[model samples]
Target: MFLAWNEITRSKLRYALIISVMFLISYLVFFLTGLAYGLAQDNRTAVDKWQADGIVLSDESNTNINMSMIPLKSLDDVTAKEKAALGQTAAVIQLDKKGAEKVNASFFGINKDEFLMPDIVEGRAFDTDDETVVNNSLKEENGFKLGDTIKLAGNEKKLKIVGFTENAKFNVAPVLYVSINTFQEIRFEKVDTTENARINAVVVRAKEGAMKNVDLAGNDLKSYGIQTFINKLPGYNAQVLTFGFMIGFLIVIAAIVIGIFIYVLTMQKATIFGIMKAQGISGKYISISVIVQTFVLAVLGISLGLLGTVGTSFVLPTAVPFQSNWLFFLAIGGAMLVIAVLGALFSVRTIVKIDPLKAIG
Candidate 1:
């Protein structure tokens, strides 16, 4: 280990370069992983908050929530089963002060008293027919305040922003909570008359002992012209899988790069190793030195990489999706350790092959 440290210290420039490369690669992997997680979370944030066991959509609409529509009658039919909170949800377009046409916003219309309403960060949940709640992030972005009015979908009547909530987003859009009647009014364009337009989907909460067979009941819902209840909200599994694959690939690539660099470095020192072997130094000592070098590089590179990730996260814009779950960081750390060990092992083969007699001659 001392000899290995001396060699690294002597070749400061080479070691620095290799460590820099490793640091960059690790940082890239960590940053990309965060981005992927943030994107998927933003895409499904609204649905996740519902905490519903199942969602009912139109059978003809396939899995696309935007195309799915369930009339009030259909929602009633499904809710009649038990433990279902039938509500309306959709994405609506509104404009910010910049007049940028079409800022997507999630519209959730439920009974004010439903348990699914997100916890409020400021103000309160909407109780009156005309009042609505908007996410604090969205409210801050648009410079909205309590009692402010915002038009929805070019509707002549503007909805009052009565409250602000935290961490509510849908399909990457900030969320707004309104009365089911108001949601139906804005979406269907009829406040006084029922024009046959209903909710896009119905959120259902299953009761205990109400049959644990969600798949069977979901299939049954299809018979009513309503799409089967999506057991898990759409896109969640796919999004997670996609991100997982990306992060996995990145880690593999980083490992490969580090292994190749370490192998080449070890090969360059083969003659020196042979000389050391001839001087009564055991092969075990040489091998241990190589392992020590690997550990040192791995620790230094990973520490720098983590620092870079943290610094980048701090300066990243809010619009840019980035999140760090500590579990993910720990998992990445474990993976890095395993890969670094594997990389070090690659140098062992070269060390074992050193010919003491040939080098001494």
Candidate 2:
């Protein structure tokens, strides 16, 4: 430890430059991961908030909310402790306020009186067909306020914003929570509440594994775990996989670059290594010193990267979709440490091969 520490202290400027590069790479990977996660979340954050076990859809719907159509009575087929009959559609809202304009949003038809309702961040849940709740993002994205009247596209209905919520989004758009009847009216342009009423799907409260048994063959129904169903959302899974692969490749490249860096440094110190061996230092000790130095450099790089991420968050524009997940960061850091160690292996091998008799001859 002393040898490694002393070497790093003596060549502080050289090590600092390498650490700076690592910091920038780490920050890039982390920030991009957050952005990818945020985009994926925007597709299903509303559903995630339900905390439901699974979803039951008509076989023909192919796991898509907008494509599914189930009879209202299908809700009764779900043998669960709790559930909600939900519906959704894409619609545009025209904000008449000075600083606001028309924005595309998703309309989610949910029972406010039921457990499926989202956590209200401000104000209260909607109690009538004329009232609606909006996602928290809309407050900033569209300059919305409580009691502001929003005109629904393709319909004459004007709903007053009653509340705001977090994690309420669908298909990459913010959600507008309304009564099931209001949703039916907006989606189907009807007032019928029962007798041949159709809904997209039924959210169930049983364990995810148990949802498959919730078959309503009489209605030609199928079910899937919450996460399983989310993956089927349009373009959601594909986007996640694409970003994951890209980030993974970048990390691998960093490993190769680290290997090259250590290889060059070790070659330059070949004579020094031979002299140390001639002075009675064991190869294993030298290897340990190299490992310690590599670890120190890795830690410094990762720490600076984390700090850079935090700093970037403050000045980042609100429109940029990005959210930090601790688990992802931890995973990245662990992978980096492992790679850094592996990168130093070439140097260790070179050190072990140095001949004591060749020095000072």
Candidate 3:
């Protein structure tokens, strides 16, 4: 530690440049991670809030909740501790009578009396067919508020926003929640009846063992665990994989860059290493100092980068999806530290190979 500190203090500029590079890389990694996580969460935040064990969708829908159609009668065939019918559709809403600004949104039909109903963050849940509860983004980003009437692009039936819910997004769009009956009317353009009523899926809370036994084959439906269902959402898996590959490649690049930096620095100090060895210093001690210096640099760089990421999140535009997971940050930082130490170790070979007699001459 003493040797490492003394060397760093003697050559502050040389080490500062390395730390700056590390800081930028770490910042990018953290920022991209937050964006990836946020976009993914936007795709399924509403579903995650269900905290259910599994979901039942029509077999032909290919695990896509948006494409699935299950007759209301099929609900009876699903065996679970509890279950609720869910209806889904995509629509456009007009913020004003002039229709100058329209926004795409996902419509979720849920029974307020059922477990799928989200807790309202502001105002109260809908009480009438014309009243609706919507994601808070509309209020925060689109100037929507309680008592504001939301007009559908082509439909004459206007919905009045009665409440706002946080973290209620689906497929990256804000969700507008309505009663199952109202949803049936908006989507089907007709009142639900005994023979024609249908829902997209059945969300259930059941034990893992029970989920295995709850078969819907007779009803022409298939069940999936919650995570499996989330993975099947349109574009969800693809986006996650794309970001994963990018972040992974960045990590590798970081390791390579740090290794190269250490290698070059070690080569430059080869004579110094030899002289130290001639003075009776052990190669092991010098190698340990190199590792300690790398660790110190990584810690400082990662800390600054994390702080910058957090600061950026606060000033980012509302449209940019971003979410922070400290645990994820910690994991990434820890991995970087280990990789950096390994990189330093790789450069230590140069120090070990330094000849005391040649260095002194």
Candidate 4:
């Protein structure tokens, strides 16, 4: 340890450059993870925020939320079987903010007093059919002010934006919460009968053995657990799989590069190590020093990488979905450290095998 510390301290600039490499790669890993997580949240934040166990939908819809339409008659049976409520009508919001200005959004038609309704971060929750609560991103994207009246571009239905909620989105777009009354009106275009207000799905709360089975009106409707439902969200799997592969590749590539770098450095010091072994200084001693050096480099690098990520967060705007999950960061950092340590081990055999005669020459 002392020998390793002595050399590293003596050649600060050389090790600093090496440490910088580790730092940059680690920062990329962490940043990409955050970006991937943010994109996923954009797809399902609204659904995730709902404290429901499962989602009920029409089986014939083939897991497509937009295609699924549950009949109102099944509501009583579903409610009796488990706690439940209605929500549907995902749409693009084309309010008349300016000529031809439109915001991509998920328009959720939900009961005013249900778990699906997220708490208001600004203004107040929707109370009547005429009011709608939107995600915070809308304030910037469309210049939406609280209590401002805007009309849906294609539907011609005017409603007031009364509140803004945080972390509510669907399919990478902002979420707009409205009354089931308004949902039916916008979706159907006519307010003739209750049957016209058919919804896409029921957000339900249930546990194993919680209720008796309830039929979803013929063979067209069924329910799924929350995680299964989330996995089926559009682009959710592809995005996650792609990013996961990127992160995995980075860690592995970094390990090989770092291991090779450390091994080359060890080979260059063959003469010194050879002399030390010849003088009974022990290959084990020098090998231990090399391990110590690798450990120091990893710790210093990961620390700086984490600090850099946190600083980047401050400079980014709220419009960017960069969520700082400390646990995730720690896990990534830990993996980097482990890979680095394993990389360091590749030099041990080289150190032990140094030829004293060749080194002396």
Best by lDDT: 3
Q: What would you estimate as the lDDT of candidate 3?
A: 0.89
User: Considering only N, C-alpha and C atoms within 3 Å, which residue pairs clash in candidate 4?
Assistant: 59-220
lDDT of 4 by residue, 1-361 (tens): 8999899999899889888988898889888888888888888888878877777888787677888877655565464235455656656565555664666777888777667788899999888888999998888766778877767757878889899998888888888899877878888875534554587888777655332343444566687777888998878999999999999899887677777778888988888899888898888898889989998988898889888988898888777878788888898888888898899898998998888888898
Q: By the lDDT metric, which is better: model 3 or model 4?
A: 3
lDDT of 2 by residue, 1-361 (tens): 9998898899989888878878888888888888898899888898888888898888888888889988888888777767788888889897755555778899888888777788888999998999999998888876789998998768988899999998788888999999988888888888676768877888888745477545454647777789889999999989999999988987887777766776787778788888998889999999999988888888888888988887887788777788888899889878987898799998899899888777445
Candidate 1, 175-212: lDDT as tens digits: 88887778777776766336464766666555542324
Clashes of each: 4, 0, 0, 1
TM-score of 4: 0.93
- Cα shift from native, residue 48, model 2 (Å): 1.2
State every prediction's TM-score relative to the real structure. Answer: 0.85, 0.94, 0.97, 0.93
Best to worst by lDDT, what's the order? 3, 2, 4, 1
Taken over the whole model, the C-alpha lDDT of each candidate is 0.72, 0.84, 0.89, 0.80
Pull out the clashing pairs in model 2.
none
Report model 2's TM-score to 2 decimal places: 0.94
User: How many angstroms is residue 127 displaced in model 3 relative to the true structure, after the best TM-score fit?
Assistant: 0.9
Which portions of model 2 miss their true places by more than 4 Å? 97-100, 207-209, 212-217, 357-361
